[model samples]
Target: MTVLDVTVPFSTQIREASQAQHTEAENSTFMSDLLSGRLGVSAFRRYTEQLWFVYRALEGVTDTLAGDPVAAPFLRPELFRTSALERDLDHLHEGADWRSALRPLPATETYAARVLEVANGWPGGYVAHHYTRYLGDLSGGQVIRGIAEKTWGFAHKGDGVRFYVFDGIANPAAFKREYRALLDAVPVDGPERLRIVDECRRAFALNTALFADLAEATR
Candidate 1:
């Protein structure tokens, strides 16, 4: 079998694990409390804005790789949704300028710093690993749907969870194929491939820790 076949199963496993762990009801409550309660909308607003900034910064990197001969074939179309989510997040509060709503958090700086450090060390297949490992947690598409439908349904219409829609993506299979192709294209020896896989796992752990930190901050 080809590398594409090998990698797709790995990617699918990660996504399945993420889906299993993500509790929509719990996430909805947390998001609702963050958006509407004394924890302050400013915190969530600032966090979302910072998330946008990070995505914008990464867009150039992604585009560069997507155009590269070695990486282009493997690049998933869904990857473009990163920028879309950033744009939606920037507009989340609407009417009220997001700039004024920004409350600088040290946690934001720390999180960005760590992620940047990791990105700087990325190998050829790193981007695919990044997507496979963290996309589900960061996107939380299904959980976001639940949150938006239950909490912001009446107040914001569909605008509140624009980040969740994936531009009306009803199927994820084709996208996964593209992603696997990208990973299979990475030219690497056995040890380097193992290292890249290890880094991917590390990336996910870091992301989970970051969310835990944010959850603690809210409490």
Candidate 2:
């Protein structure tokens, strides 16, 4: 009898495929300065403004994707940060109507549009981008939140960084584990898996572009 070797999980493949883009994003001039407390609050606010565009686009489809078997399981109320983003915006841009506070950069517009594109079709592509953004936030985003608080002297769990505060997740570690399991279980053939992996990289590339654009503008 011949033995067949089990292949690596899709989650692992995604992580590997997107690793370069992920590193570029983290090491991008904007993220590096912001995370290191070298960037001013105005720049951070600008970053948040861009985030509003991208996340709003992503969450806008949550209701639509919520019924999807592959995407539904990943959608959690706690993971939703648009409300927190609103509060952070209110605090960050007090007195101004945050609604018209800032315009999306060119890269930000592209990123937001890509998210909307996948939301209506290509569940794999949708999942790929969703997993890329939210998971990235839940992971390294904590560091950025901390830097924001310490640099700007915002209260812990306070308005400025509230977007990073996940009130719904009691244990983020466990939630992450469960999320990865869900990633491992996404039903896809080899070609579809490759496509999703490609989308993940594309998502990260879009993010890096946003960062690069921000860095250029802020400088």
Candidate 3:
């Protein structure tokens, strides 16, 4: 049983531990093409469609864990993205019913299922998934938003790109600092901390897998 050294801040531990996975996810083929403007609007729309399923599953467990000691500290309602995703889908679908024809790729199904599984049973694990997602959105996700807006000629932070726009967060950098503080203070033991770090890596791999699926399907 390897115990994580508590002398290091938990936030830094997880960040360092998951750095490789994070880099792999960022360098995924689909994302590289999308960000480089090689992929078309349909590709971006399809990617956003997949995000709706994943966010729905993630947010679905929020209410259940709202009062949980381990999960409650990370539950910021403003971080929720289902509504924003829906609006983006509305625009992507040109006002059609996205849900009626919605389907998750196999990887997305597995990813969303894992999110629900951990969220239902382990608050620490749930936070692992949460941190992997929202933090990345605040950070590298801005690049995607910028590329999408420029490539597709969408209005700035409107309609199609709303998912990357965090209207409630006035300062993303400060909010990320506060979020890392919450991770640093997550009230869990050494083994649990290690487990959470592993989960964060897994979350990134799952995300990368989803992108791989998109690449294959679009190819």
How far residue 62's Cα lies from its native spot in candidate 3, in Å, is 1.1
Q: List model 2 lDDT by residue over 117-177, tens digit each.
A: 9889877888998898888788898988888888999899898899999988998898888
lDDT ranking of the models: 3, 2, 1
lDDT against true structure, model 3: 0.93
TM-score of each: 0.63, 0.95, 0.98
**Tens digit of lDDT per residue, candidate 1, span 1-219?**
123234455545434444423343224433546544445544454445655544544443555565565445544454544555545555566645665555434555554554455444553444534564335533454554464456544233245455555544456555546555555556665555555555555545544444555566667
Clashing pairs in 3: none
| Per-model tally of clashing residue pairs | 1, 0, 0
Candidate 2 segments whose C-alpha is farther than 4 A from its true place? 1-6
TM-score for predicted model 2 compared with the true structure: 0.95
Q: Between candidates 1 and 3, name the one with more favorable TM-score.
A: 3
Candidate 3 lDDT trough over 10 residues, lowest sum: 1-10
Q: Which run of 10 residues does model 1 get worst, by summed lDDT?
A: 17-26
Give the higher-lDDT candidate: 1 or 3: 3
lDDT of each: 0.49, 0.86, 0.93
